[model samples]
Target: MNIADVDTPAVLIDLDRVEANLKRTQDYADAHGVRLRPHIKTHKLPRFAKRQIELGAIGITVQKLGEAEVMADAGIADIFLPYNILGASKLARLQALNERVTIRVTADSAETVAGLSEAFAGAEKPLEVLVECDTGMGRCGVQSPQAAVELAKVIAGSPGLSFAGLMTYPAAGKYAEAARWLAEGKRLLEEAGLPAKIISNGGTPDLWHAHEAEVATEHRPGTYIYMDRYQVEKGVATLDDCALTVIATVVSRPTETRAVIDAGSKALTSDTLGLTGFGHVLGYPGAVITSLSEEHGTIDLSASDKKPKIGEKLRIVPNHCCVVSNLFDVVNLTQGEAVVETVPVAARGRVD
Candidate 1:
């Protein structure tokens, strides 16, 4: 089917570009002597995740247990869930998933370790847990290297938990600081007779600098598969590297400088990522996605005299591709202007 024949507000994935991205990232990891555990949160497709493993990815990373379950069912043996899994119901499901595949998770506190130990205690295989350190992201991680070592010790002592090593999501361009934090934590663990086995650090923005963190043995990058406007703006990727775009049709031409498309926040997402607009129109060099409501995207044509007329079609590169992938139920895999296949987003809305 031709891309033009597809319905409006549809997500288009350039298959060729996707393959290129996969190869480039894998090659970089291989050359650096670091393991590549591509995060599946961006694409959330079993086909892509499987392809990543086939292309030398040591494993795949999922933020939630629901996503991990989907990947495991698809024959992905090695899955790493970096988020802390809490609650009895969630832990029960996590235990069930662990039985099906090799799983590793992260912990930042003694309470989290206690819960994990209780959930997996007496199991045939102990669960692997990593100490999550907050180098600078200031998110859900231990604030200091000492805290990290303490957590690691707790995991090592827990009956059902094994201290796998350290993990961190450092702020952009802070690779050195993150490495120092992980190194210190590792040193302390070794001094206490507990040697860290795996040190994982990840962020798409600092992916190229992964080797700078000498303590890290693996890197997890989610958005590198299908970069968006934010990555482009941050110099992490070029426009030619982006593999996904939203195809929208002009539905209204309200004024000379104003036009509307069928895609809205529901389709394109509302995350601007501090950008001035929502997305970048592909062919329209100066067009700006001024605003996005529930079902309509307003475009500003003030920068250029040429404006989109009613019924015209346009492709938009969203500011954030990960959220946009979750917003859609299916994505069209395209080669040039032809749609080769439609893939279901199997892990969408699996927040639990």
Candidate 2:
């Protein structure tokens, strides 16, 4: 399909850039001797996950049980979930999923561990559980090393759970401190005779410094596959590195300095990620995406030396590419200007 033939407010994934992003990150993991178990929350495509494994990923990581089921159906054998899963409904599904693939999960509390233990108690194999540690991100992890080891002991002694290791998603730019915290947790685990098997640390904001977290045996980076404006602002990716972009048509030129595009918050997303604008206008370096409603994105073309006229198309690099993937059902894969293939987002709403 030609680029012009495709409808406006569509997502475009550059095939060339995708390959470069995959190989570059994989090579870094290889050189650093750390396993690259990429998180699939970014692309959520089975094909891309398979490509990641082909490039040398240890396995794939999913943030939700529903996502794991989708990938498992696609023949992805191993998956690591880095969220604290609970509730009987989700646990029942987790049991069914565990029967089909190798799975590891993280827990920050005893209640979560109990649920996992009960779900896999009579299974043929024990479920491996990692104690989620909050080195500094302050999201969903145990606060201190002592707390981590205590949870590890609880998991190890559980009916159907084995303490695998420690996992954390630290605050960006504070990996060194997070490492120190994780290292202490590792030391305590060792002293307690429970050797950690996987020290997992991840975040795309500090992709290049992933190796510096020496305690982490595996890294889970999701956004590197389709770099976004947030990654660019953080200096983790350049605009050229961005593989995903929103193609929107200029609908109305309300004024000489203002224009409206078909893509809006539903396409470009409202996640500013601390940036000034919603997204970066690809060609109009000076253009600012001032505001976005559900179906309209207001563009301030005054700053731009050149502006698009009515009926012209604009490409926007969203603030967060992962969220954008969930909004679109299909993403057009293109090489240059020709749309080579378009695929459904297999796990689009598998956010259970």
How does candidate 1 score on lDDT?
0.91
Best by the TM-score measure:
2
Candidate 2 residues lying further than 4 Å off, grouped into runs, are none
The residue-level lDDT of candidate 2 at 238 comes to 99
TM-score of 2: 0.99
Off by over 4 Å in 1: none
Clashing pairs in 2: none
TM-scores vs. true structure, each candidate: 0.98, 0.99
Highest lDDT against the true fold, candidate: 2
Q: What is the lDDT of residue 229 in candidate 2?
A: 95
TM-score attained by model 1: 0.98
Error of 1 at 268 (Å): 1.0
Per-candidate RMSD vs. true structure? 0.9, 0.8
Tens digit of per-residue lDDT, candidate 1, span 1-352: 9999999999999999899998998898889887889999999999999999999999999998889989988899999999888899999988998898999999988888999999999888899999888999889899988888878888988998999998999886677988998899989889988888989897788888887788898999989999999999998899999999999999999889999999999999999888999999988879999999989999999996678879988999999999999999999999998999999999987897
lDDT of 2 at 132: 92
Residue 143 error, candidate 2, Å: 0.3
